[model samples]
Target: MLRPALLALFLTGATAPAFAQPPTETVPLLREIKQWVIGCDNLRNCHALSAPSGVDEEDYSSLTLHLWHQAGPQGYLRLRFDHRGEDVDLSTLLLDGKPLGLELTQDLHIELDDQGGDPEVQSFGGIEDAAARRWLQRLRNGQRLQLPGDEAAHVSLSGLSASLLLMDAVQGRLDNVTALSRPGKGAASEVAPRAPAPVLRKFTAAAPLTAEEQAGLVAAALQAVKPEEGEPEATVGALTAQQAMTVTRYDCAAYNCEFDVSSRERQAPYKETPMDLQPLPLEDAALQGSVGYDEASGTLSYFYKQRGIGDCGGGASWVFDGKRFQLSEFHRMPRCTGVGYGDWPALWTTVPAP
Candidate 1:
């Protein structure tokens, strides 16, 4: 009962992005899947980058391909390499055994700067439209890229396709450019960029709940208690309170579980609805787990199993200013091959910017 109720709350309470606190020195990340990291700034300039995977910690140096675009569709591509030892600046790269000379400042405006001591940073940009398209194709098709040396190091090209699609989503152009570049390759846009952090809205309400109000809150959550399609038996838990909120958890069957949420006092619980998580821009939105609230900071958070995919899903947090909830944080990992993937807790945090 609690699971279904909470499921309904996530579905019903899901709303559009709102204005929140100011951003930090670095733009907050929207997602990190395998090697890719996607995010943007207040200026609406979006970025997508990727690095190698499957390497040990000692051998886990950093080699990333970063792509960015502004609100006007003006874009650039950058490749950055950072290691613990002396800085390594690469002028050319060999991908899948094909040696290609990189025209630094000419073809791509290059930036070689010192980031503290070790871990030198070299970035390439100022790419023309033609070159950007070409590079994207090469990276996707090629298996690996290595610096020319007697002891050359290699970086994996895994997840390059998904990273490019994320770039496309951030830029608001869904022409399937990544797929179109490579004929006969068929894969839908793997992941979508999340809505921007919403601005917080304030409201006036009672300081705490009366006994009758608490009963009504429990009643609101009970509405979502129903058997899922495959599971005939359901186990609803007792209502509990934490901070200034109340919660009820339930186990439907198998991997199906949920939690419901309500403010301690009079605010209505998120409505109940049936819809799968993931597949954003949902005709209907739903969450898969318990809703958590931090009274001191006015934050609401939850994690959910992505629709159709059991291995990975998304997590999000909102700032509740008493009136309405606004987006504060979001994360999505499309594939998690790690041990115990199903119980992976959504671990995103929200620290108000100074």
Candidate 2:
């Protein structure tokens, strides 16, 4: 089945790597958006500022762009305003080319730059949960979006053909915009109807992170928790390390959390590091994580959900049980400043103490 699917995808120009690895935030999303075609004129827009959701408004019109970039525990992630004009388009949330019905506008949570001390997050129309799920189906399966960002949104996979299509889209737009802006260095070349050009190129392979590399990132995230003490043996996600996390409660699930950490108001920008996490350390760790050991594997499982404040504005949760683990972090990547949420990656799973 996998081989047939792979072959069919190649024939249809929808191909990616067999083992497409997880990606790291190395470049800003905007940096990948070489150029944009807005409205009927295919006008080249500047400061396209941010990535906008596609609106099926009969044409490829540009919308008021909103840009966001935030730093994560290790790198960063970018999320942009889904604005295509006035109303947020739900098509942005749709599963491209899929019959599945999904709309990003189903339940939107918008956070503006400033709203007093509190950030502004407008919660409203959003995509159907089913649609979101379908959109993420490929991702959950481990396929990654190719580089050049212009490739079909959330593609199943791709190789040279996919890469060329994206490169052409980007380069073509650039050429168009350049011709328009430069307007005839030869005085008469201004109206040369822009050169009709197309360049074909092979897709280059992107670097895939190793399990150990991902583990390092996981180890860094565990350090972000600002607790007075952390379980050095705790685990989450796919990787594990000699680490530390907080102990919110020893007998939590069965014991009603006798000890509490409800005093100080939660503030964020919880930074991760290679250093051990301190329990109740900076009041910056959104919440302390706890580990439960099972004699079955002698590995410690961890669980905790936390949100950041100020610069680091996002949240994450950790869950690990020895042999297997999952480190899921969240951040408002669109507003990616030095402080952004959903920027961290979890890569660790607990192991027996040596």
**Best by TM-score, which number?**
1
Q: Which candidate number would show the highest lDDT if scored against the true structure?
A: 1
Residue 230, model 1: Cα distance from true site in angstroms: 20
Stretches off by above 4 angstroms in model 1 are 1-66, 73-94, 98-143, 146-198, 202-244, 252-257, 264-280, 283-285, 305-311, 337-354
- lDDT of every predicted structure (CA atoms): 0.44, 0.26
Query: Residue 312 of candidate 2: its Cα lDDT?
Result: 19
TM-score of each: 0.42, 0.21
Candidate 2 local lDDT, 1-354, one digit each (tens): 012332122122111222111121111112222222111001111112222223333222222122111111111112233222233433343233333234433334554433232233222222333443333333333322321222332322213122222322322221221221221232221211211111212212223334554455444444544444434322222123332222234333331222222111111222232322222211324333433433222222333433233321223332333222222221222232222222122111111222
lDDT of 2: 0.26
- Model 1 TM: 0.42
Q: Which regions of candidate 2 are displaced past 4 Å?
A: 1-64, 67-246, 249-311, 322-324, 330-354
Measured with C-alpha atoms, the lDDT of residue 325 in candidate 2 is: 25
